[model samples]
Target: MHAPRATSNPFVGLHHADTPLLLPNAWDHASALAMAGQGFRAIGTTSLAVAAAVGLPDGASATRDETLRLALLLGSQQFLLSVDAENGFSEDPDEVAEFARQLAAVGAVGINLEDGMGAVDRHAAKIAAVKSAVPGLFVNARTDTYWLGEHDETETLSRLDVYQQAGADGVFVPGLASAREIGALVARLDVPLNILYSPVGPAVPHLADLGVSRISFGSFLYRRSLGAALEAVVEIREGRRPGGRAPTYEDIQSLGADPARHD
Candidate 1:
């Protein structure tokens, strides 16, 4: 088996770099290679995109096999890969750990597991199991209180504390847009804080200033790509020129060639 690349293992270290790590989440081999071409050393897979591609529902544990298949396909690539396995595809901690083991064996350096506002202990068990199964894998334990519309600061803090204590390399809070709230969480958390980047939320630099260790563009790029394609077809039908830069056929084909190195 090929050894996991040095670039892949230092994914957690990227979180501690001078600036917050800006992770561009990709949906497929082409999107991943395209982002790597643009100089993103570490790329994450978006679960929503993975599920949508297979006509399955996201966050419903309906795409475990598809998610793993994507990971296996991208694991050998040059960029550091982080797989967003929604809820680890099962409620059983052992099953989640087994899945994480597979991801790591294939070359993924990190795994993002979300709580989805489930029981804190169950999520913690999954996190701990993953840590024990693959100690080197960076488990990004995510709490969706904000994304789920709970917005309970007390509950958020409580859940994060348990996740971190259970051995999450970092904690991700999606849908957290307030600078004050973000800063407060940053101050309180011991591990790296990963914030999902929202278009209307604080910009990258502001997030860095807020002490965010990582910023993930989760599903935004995938959604935008679809939106852009729709806009292009509509424009063509309306007898107007498409606005954005679309790559030539050859340019796209090149994405499947030799993967670009971070160096």
Candidate 2:
């Protein structure tokens, strides 16, 4: 088999901009291509959507094959792509490194690995191994202290420090919405700080002002899309029109056509 072609690596530079990079997460090709058609330079995969589509649980190390397949399909596309490989799908650091290599080989420019508040040493070792295996792949190290109910600021900082030392290109802290805390984390990290965008939390401009380099809508879009579909069905059943403009059949079909001419 031929080696994976090198991607242009535009994601890292996106962090240094005056404004924070707004990364929308997609579940499949249609979502990804549609986002890219709208001129989004970078798109990330939502692991929850991927696992749900296949009747599996997210963050349970069950969607490794599905994740790899999605990466292979999206990584070779026109835009920069990142895969959300939750905890690298294995406890073994070497297995995680191998998974990173496979993702990189398929043209993925970045990978998001979450610790799920597990052993810090194991997660750090995985990060180090992935970096060693694929130096070019942007490893976004994620800690779930806030999401998993451990809101200890000291623990969060300690894990981030270990991951950064292990060669993470960026640090992601989901469930962190306070601007003061976000600013403090950004100030403490040498690498770019990725914050999960919360609708009720700080706005994009506010986050940019707080020195957040990257903002991600993790699974929020996917969940909202499903909710919208259900709402539309309810409206139709009640003999009422759905609220928002729906995409036409042709418009939906066009996403699979010549992506180069999408715009």
Candidate 3:
């Protein structure tokens, strides 16, 4: 298995207004390989999928090992892999820095670190530590201000300001889904802006037009895949073929051996 070229902070910054990063959220190696074959330059792991599949909880920082293992697997493949380390799995900056180091050692190119509605100063410190530990890893600093119902613009700006000053390459807003707000944020920030994709929310093209540099699917694809699998099982029980253009078993075998190959 050939490893992909190591990524830098500029790799994430390359995605921009006219060409936003269409990041596909992967649950495991096979899915990630499939999307990589389909021409996605970078792949992001979904925390919800990793947690749910292992029967553990999601976003409470219960999947550190799982996240690392997945990153190790994808790192050998021919694409940039970004691990979602929710809240850095601890409030302590040292632990988060260690986690970032593990990911960088395994060939991961980027990491998603979230505030998780924690203290802004603490999260900023964590981001700084992660950067100190893994200088090449693209740190996408996430703020959950809108998701947590404290949508105070002043406070949100203050938190992001701290993160950017602390050396975050990009900032992510998971639940922000407005063109006006997004435009304002993009115009104000010096670093790249990442927006989470919502099915009912703004589309990728719309987000690109609004000046978003990166668009993350988060857990949307993972949940949608689960929904699709359940629906397929029900359809089979009803004496009908399942939906989706699935690959054959042999195709999957080939992917296991070499993920970069589509056929």
Q: Rate the local accuracy (lDDT) of all candidates.
A: 0.91, 0.90, 0.85
Model 1 C-alpha RMSD vs. true structure (Å) is 4.2
Q: What TM-score goes with each of the models?
A: 0.95, 0.95, 0.92
Better of 2 and 3 by lDDT: 2
* Candidate 2, run of 10 with poorest lDDT: 1-10
**Comparison by TM-score, 1 against 3, better one:** 1
lDDT, candidate 2, equals: 0.90
- Tell me which of candidates 1 and 3 scores higher on lDDT: 1
> Which lDDT value does model 1 have at 224?
99
Which residue pairs come into collision in candidate 3?
Answer: none
Number of backbone clashes in candidate 2? 0
lDDT of 1: 0.91
Q: Write model 1 residue lDDT over 83-112, tens digit each, in one string.
A: 999999999999999999999999999999
